[model samples]
Target: MTFALVRVRRGDLRLDLESFARYAGVHPDLVRRLVALGLLEPVRERGEWWFGADQLAELARIERLRRGCDLNYAAIGLVLDLLDRIAELEAELRTVRRSRPPTGGAPWTRTDSR
Candidate 1:
């Protein structure tokens, strides 16, 4: 239940649509279709699609969902949302467990031996 921190770089953090597609390990057509389906939104610069490095992870996630499941784009979004909630719940559970005291089965008792 560990989370990886994603760090964004100041400069050279942007990639064009093709580079983004390559970085995501998905097809360009799929990227276009995702944009058309509203599953992804990229910045349009001078008629070119540009994506930030932050989106690389998200795109990879989407690619995994698209390839791993038979779900449509909308369903994929729902699944991602559920997964995020599950992670949050798991973290909270860990915190609660840490705060609780350990319990033993029974207390020790001493009997008179005289």
Candidate 2:
């Protein structure tokens, strides 16, 4: 699997609920709703919720899907399920190919002299 490395600006490195809401261009209640829906996870530190660069990126993706597409949460869930199945099938195909014998014919044995 491939992972992306995000570089956060100085002030954007760590965010509380308010900062995360402002940075993600959404309302705090909406952010809370996303958290409730398992779309975003917040870090708990010293009695405060914190968000990182990855969380910001995930929020952006969710927002884009919400704005750019007509998919509701249930539809998004179905799409994610299909994508996961595709990944599993691809992995299985790779494993099956690796376990198969070579397509070339077997080497010929020496025949009796004439």
Candidate 3:
């Protein structure tokens, strides 16, 4: 799929590309490559790329995938996309649970008599 996985955190301040790379503990060149690869999207402002403060989490996630799983950029992109989908599904499940009326009895009782 050629889908772009983007998650902008609400109320986060923006930083220029260099500043973002510094804060993310990665080289600016690496960030640029990731952006170009469609793995990350930063705003272009006055010849500079601007990123959200929330991208810190994303940077860390990318690093984690690289280090822990030894995944390349392409694989990281797919894994992150799947992770985002899982998060969205969990949020929807929580909303559905909240909207449902509470039952007097428990959801279910465990049966271990056997």
User: Can you write out model 1's per-residue Cα lDDT over 8-107, one digit (the tens) per residue?
Assistant: 4556467777777776777879889878876678777679887776578777788789788877788888888899899999999999979978644333
Where model 1 places Cα greater than 4 Å from the true spot, the runs are 1-12, 32-50, 105-114
Which residue pairs come into collision in candidate 2? Answer: none
**How would the candidate models be sorted by TM-score, starting from the highest?**
3, 1, 2
Poorly placed runs, candidate 3 (over 4 Å): 1-12, 106-114
lDDT of 3 by residue, 1-114 (tens): 121223446665777777777777789899988997788888875686778755767788888999999999999999999999999999999999899887555646635432
**How many pairs of residues collide in each model?**
0, 0, 0
The top-ranked prediction according to TM-score is 3
RMSD of each: 9.4, 9.6, 8.2
For residues 1-114, what per-residue lDDT tens digits would candidate 2 score against the true structure?
Answer: 222223356655667888778877788898888888777888777787788878988787777777788777656556656766999999999999899887565446435332
For model 2, the stretches where C-alpha displacement exceeds 4 angstroms are: 1-12, 77-114
Instruction: List per-prediction Cα lDDT, in the order shown.
Output: 0.74, 0.74, 0.79
